[model samples]
Target: MKRGEAILVPLGAMIAGLLVFGLFCAALGLNPLAVYASIYKAGFGSWYSWQNTLVRASPLLLCGLCTAIPARAGMIVIGNEGAVVAGGLGAATVGLATLSLPPVLSLTIMALSAMVCGGIWIAFGAALQHYRGVSAVISGLLLNYLAVALMNQLIEGPLRDPSSFNSPASYPLTPDHRLAYFAGTHIHHGLIFGAVACVLAWFLIDRTTFGFAMKIAGGNVRAARLAGLPVGRLVVIAGFLGGACAGLAGMIEVAAVHGRANESLNAGYGYSGILVAFLARQNPLVIVLVSLLTGGLLASGGVLQREHDLPDATIAVLQGILFLFILLSDTLYGRLPFFRSRTPEPKPHAIAA
Candidate 1:
């Protein structure tokens, strides 16, 4: 089952998701294949479609880290969306406040500040877990609510743009300050950052001493502590790293996509990252792949809405079904015959003897 779980299961589940969608479409008297074709044309049929998918997936890739990386140490960090908002604000604030700085210098400061914001956000949950025995899940979710409220307050009050009598947002970043898209491509450097981060995370979690420590601690915290591993530090660092991913996502949104912090800054990339992490089974590289897949769906949502008269709710329903099925299947891995442990067979009855 583990072997099956590696790829085949996910593929099967995805097929199942499509079948479920077909069933739903039938009930609604719509053609499921037509809708799916629309999704394909809008999401992957052209360079433009692929670019949009990558653009959207870039944040999700980082946001996925916000959940998957920490999960290595048994932490359920879900406040990535908040970290994203805070990170974007941090980047924007630095960019706006330091107009005299070189672009590289300013961008560095902005990205670092955003990371700090995200790190601290998850650190709060870690602190609660270490000191108070509070559930990280609850604390993280509550932190999300607080973060959203804080974002609202900041955009509506302290950070409100004075010039544009339009949407509530912080002062926009200067065009010169925005990250440049590669020539002939809409995808920005955030996709590069997300890829780098995912690779780094794979190294940290699967190839290093820290990774070994997390494996030990995550397997048995008590035994790990007895073995002199700094379990607390591992957990805390994992949580912090998770938060940093979210924060970096925010920075990307502000510096590359939106050019400012605003209400839309918390547009649920964080939440979607959670879904991606679950789908990837918390594997960093797999998270990137899953993010791209989901990003394609997201990219198609607009076209699905406009061209086919499909409501946004249609996409939402698809996402819900996929997420629900993926998570539900997680418990079944390692238990099936295809994944069952293999033991050496006892020597055949000594026919030779």
Candidate 2:
């Protein structure tokens, strides 16, 4: 495969995917054209709606990064959920522990706690991959379940708010401790943080030396090892960074949205993040655009359910279709002649250790 061929495969796949979506919508007694209109109107027709979509997309963009970064190193770390909850729990702890501290000091502590906890949460998986050569996909996935279990234990046990007789959740942050919205919108600080993280990820993967090494290792681990690059360190760091990004996303979800750690924090963003990463080819910048697109799907689901007499499950159907096409990305890449030409012929780059 060569460069030009690589480009065509994805392009062709996009066209085919749209057709599939259209067919699915039509068979369900819905007009694809009108459904699209409804989607546009519901999501972007009103400023409030658009803002809401952005808010939803904020965490998704970060979670997408959680998948995208590690992909470059050939590790499929699906444990973003663990990092997210861990980060959220860490942030809640920070806020509660520093209730009497100055506002700035408290905020800093909360942010650092989330980042550190998120990093450490996924670092365990990275260690396993590097030390034992365990499959990251499997290890990370199992760890996600573990994280969920841990969250349940913490919230129901030690972190439970005794004052909440009706709801079971971690202690809520005081009003002052919650992150405020941006100047003009209900969108919170997390959007800006997500945007910044995306930019940083793009730079790290596309412009930095580390990125290049990871790409090579991902393309062929044996080749990379032959070239004497530190494959173990690269793979582990990729997973750790990816997990940390997800953890920050969790922190943002708790601090800005929930204002307290709860089961609601497990909103499936971790799972959806996988979709975004795959659709974007696991490219950081592309993840941002894809997140917004999926966010619109979520934002519009309620509208369709209310006005079109469609079941709320329409969103699930659409999502299912999207994931179907997304997983076919590998097949699309090789099958399309134009994109097949884009894939590089075998390279002689030095093998990493």
Candidate 3:
């Protein structure tokens, strides 16, 4: 596809999605233009709102990498939700257990625990695919349900803090171990982690030899095998790396935002990250930008509900529409006439004869 069309087609779909969603708003006797403007204001108009957007985008950046990385290895795992929850639980467990340790050591242990737990949770799916011939997608999706149920069981029963009677939550981490906010903003250090992770991911995928092997494996498993590449190992490593990022996202949510593990950890950022990955065409660098855009849209949901008298799900519907259009437009990438290469017409120089 031509470079311009590669970019324009997606933009066109986004525009189409907005127009279609506008019609839906019109049916409800609301002005689409006003709604769009409100979304912009609530998400980015003020410095405070920008901080909120960045705060939300932090997890999204990590979670989106969960999908984008595995995709590079030709896997379709969507079990990041499970990884996030499990990671959060693991972090909480470790944090509470090591409360007497030095603050920095305790926090480091908690982060590592979260990443290992999350990585194991998702890697199980890859293991099943490689060993048992089960589908990765099925295993990953089913694992999400299992992870949430397990988290609820542990949180409400064994992990729950007795003092937190009003809410089912784990024991909060000590103040010293909790992540510090950046300057005067509500944003925390997790944003830095997420940005650094994306840059690392991009480098690993584009500049490293292992990443090239993964691409070859993803493109053709048979060819990869014939070339003596360890396809299974690559898939497993990719799955682990992806899940680790997601797990870290969960850990950040607890240490930075919630201070404890609870049902609130199931914030759907995992699912939303899938959209971000797809929207960014699975490029780790682009995922950062797309995640920020998605985060803005999510932050605007409350504004739409309050000021416009719309349901909280209004943004979800628009997102769903946008996702649908994006999928439909996927086929337009190289198929559009503008994207196709053309040959010059025959020269008329022979007429001189």
Candidate 4:
């Protein structure tokens, strides 16, 4: 698709989604405009709301990258939610273990451990796809279930902090281990990390030889192999790098927000990330903007429930409608005249004979 059409497709899909949502609201005897107003107010009307949106966007940005990167290699990895939990669990364990260490060192350990664990979690699916010929989608999904179950068992069993009896969570990190917030805002440095990761991912995918190879592999694996590309390695590395970003997100969530691993760590950022990636058309840079937009939508859920007397499921319905439209819009890409390649007419016969 042409760049202009690529951009327009998602916008058009979003418009259609909003129309559907409005129709649904009207059917439910509610004012769609009023619900939309509440969404805007809760998401962007004030500095506080902006902060809330950005805070939610932080992890979403990374989780979007988790799926976006591997997508370049034509791999569908949907297990990032599990990777996030695994990463958070790793970070919490490391943070507590390294309590006596210097802040920088402890934080480094926590971040590394989280990334490694998360990377491993998703890489397993990639390996299965390459080596065992298993479907990545199936493996990735099953892995998510396993990760969630494992996280619950650990936190509620061996890893549970006695003091957190009510929550059944790991012990909180020491104050020094926690990430500091930006001045006077609920936003933490995790936002910076997410932004940087997206930028770096953009550069890696758009400017690096490895990224070029991965794109080639994605486009045509047999051709890439004939061209001497390490297709298998590229696929695995893409999955690993994607998961690493997710892991970093988990680390930030635990170290900056929750200060430990808990059920709250499974905040659906991973699942929402898939939508963000699709909306962005898998562009790393665009993922950041899309994440913020989706984050705002998610942030408004509470306001939708409280102010409009709507159920919490309202957001899910909207998201589902949006996702449905996006899928439909995919077929519109090359079919649009704006996206179709133009061919110059053949030159007139020289000098009219």
Q: Each model's TM-score, in the order given?
A: 0.93, 0.88, 0.95, 0.95
Ranking by lDDT: 4, 3, 1, 2
lDDT of each: 0.86, 0.81, 0.89, 0.90
Model 1 C-alpha RMSD to native: 3.0
lDDT of 1 at 56: 90
Clashes of each: 3, 23, 0, 0
Which regions of candidate 1 deviate over 4 angstroms?
A: 334-353
Instruction: Check candidate 1 and list the clashing pairs.
Output: 1-338, 1-339, 2-339
Q: Local error of candidate 1 at 32, Å?
A: 0.8
Off by over 4 Å in 2: 1-15, 309-313, 334-353
Q: Which rank order by TM-score, best down to worst?
A: 4, 3, 1, 2
- In model 3, the Cα lDDT at residue 238 comes to 89
Report how far residue 140 has shifted in candidate 3, in Å: 1.4
User: Of the pair 2 and 3, which is ahead by lDDT?
Assistant: 3
Per-prediction CA RMSD (Å)? 3.0, 5.2, 3.1, 2.5
Which has the better lDDT: candidate 2, or candidate 4? 4
List model 1 lDDT by residue over 205-314, tens digit each. 99999988988877889999899999898888888888888899999999999889887787878888888998888999999899988898888989988877879768
For residues 276-320, write the lDDT of model 4, one tens digit per residue. 888888999999899888888999999998998999878888988
> Where does candidate 3 have its weakest 10-residue lDDT segment?
337-346
